[model samples]
Target: MVWTEILVPVLGGDNDAALLAIAKALAEPFNAAINVVYASPSPISLFSWAGEGGYGPTDVAVAAMQESADRGQARCRDLLASLDYPKTKFEAVTADDWIGLRTVSRLADVVIWERSVSRGHGFLANAFQQILLDERRPAIIADKPTKADGTIAIAWDGGREASRALRRAVPLLRGATKVVILSVPHAMAHPCDGSRAVDYLADQGIKADAVVLHTQGDAGQAILGGVRDLGADILVAGAFGHPRLQRFIFGGTTQLLLDSGSPAALFLSH
Candidate 1:
């Protein structure tokens, strides 16, 4: 479970620097290849033409779209050139090119996605969600650079998703100066205690301390506070641990974490 290939999706925005900085920090230790991708939307859909007037010409619309995509690609290349990370590889592809993007994601050990990308509902958002949901890969949601050797916190709940996350985070945890398992006892009934998670990490030769949190609000808030208090650079947790229906309407812990502006980077697996 070592990370060898890291994927970072870019949109040619000013935030690309922040995203790449996070990727570089994660890649440096492992000597991993950073795949910097510029993902653009496909040509304008047929139904999305002039609303009040008749539909516009298809060729013109597609040409305009391609021109915009070209500009985005240029921006990504320029940024990569400026930073000059030795192990970075750059590519530009359309978000609708599912087969192509999925193939690239398949080989990636972990994807580094920007916080804004997760919040978006556009084409890039669809691509980001597919990489996690359809591909079933691990990801690091970051808004800024994360410390490569800082304390890492695992949000443990004794669920299948949490177990998967813990297992996937082993390689990264091995490098952390400190590891902590944060559990919310009052949030939900756990199948097993946080000690089980700590023991599992111990088996992997990674010593971790477990702390039970008694919270009055949501589990997500408690976990965030715990990470902040511990000064952890990264939070390892399962994405969408609750049922889809429940999270979709009322928003679950995963949603809350994703929407948060916390500085702590999230290492999530679904």
Candidate 2:
């Protein structure tokens, strides 16, 4: 159950390094190919130039985009070449933000992205939230687990999503030194003792402790506190779902986690 391809969608800024850090940490050890995709729409997509000199303006805009893509690819190539890891490789692609990155994500084994953790309805944040909510989206590597051989935590709720996340995170779990299954019964729809999750991991040769939390804040905060208390370097959990309007009014646990400056890597699934 090794990852073959890891997709990393970089939107530039400080996220570039943050995204690469997680991708490298996860991919290097597994010898997986890291695909750093940059979503930069064609320059022509930005404007409406109907009264153009025939097709000259359109051609110019497209050429501009092509050149920009080339330069970006060149930088990636140089960076990868410098690393020169025979097992771990790198590839770069430029595509339309709406469809291309999503397409690539569908085929990837896992995705390591920047947990920007912003408290705004910005485009990037919205796009990332949409991805997290995508049921078809692959397993994600978040908050940057530089290495897998560390304490790992799982937020358990006796739900399908949490179960799926545990399975998806097995590869990394294999290297964990300690596993803590934190069951926050506060706001959970199907609260359990977390013993089943612990037993399941034990069956897979991963010993874990089951801890049911009784907290004052929401379930998300309880999970956060549990992770910090356990000294876990990575967190695995199912992404809880909510109505769109409700999420807009009251954010879901997964959304809040995504927006926090997490101290551990978060592996979440829908």
TM-score of every model versus the real structure: 0.91, 0.84
Pairs in clash, predicted candidate 1: none
Model 1 alpha-carbon drift over 4 Å, by segment? 44-54
Which candidate number maximizes lDDT? Answer: 1
Per-candidate RMSD vs. true structure? 2.2, 3.4
- Clash tally, candidates in order: 0, 0
Cα displacement (angstroms), candidate 2, residue 22, comes to 2.2
Worst 10-residue lDDT window for candidate 2 reads: 117-126
Candidate 1 has its poorest 10 consecutive residues by lDDT at 43-52
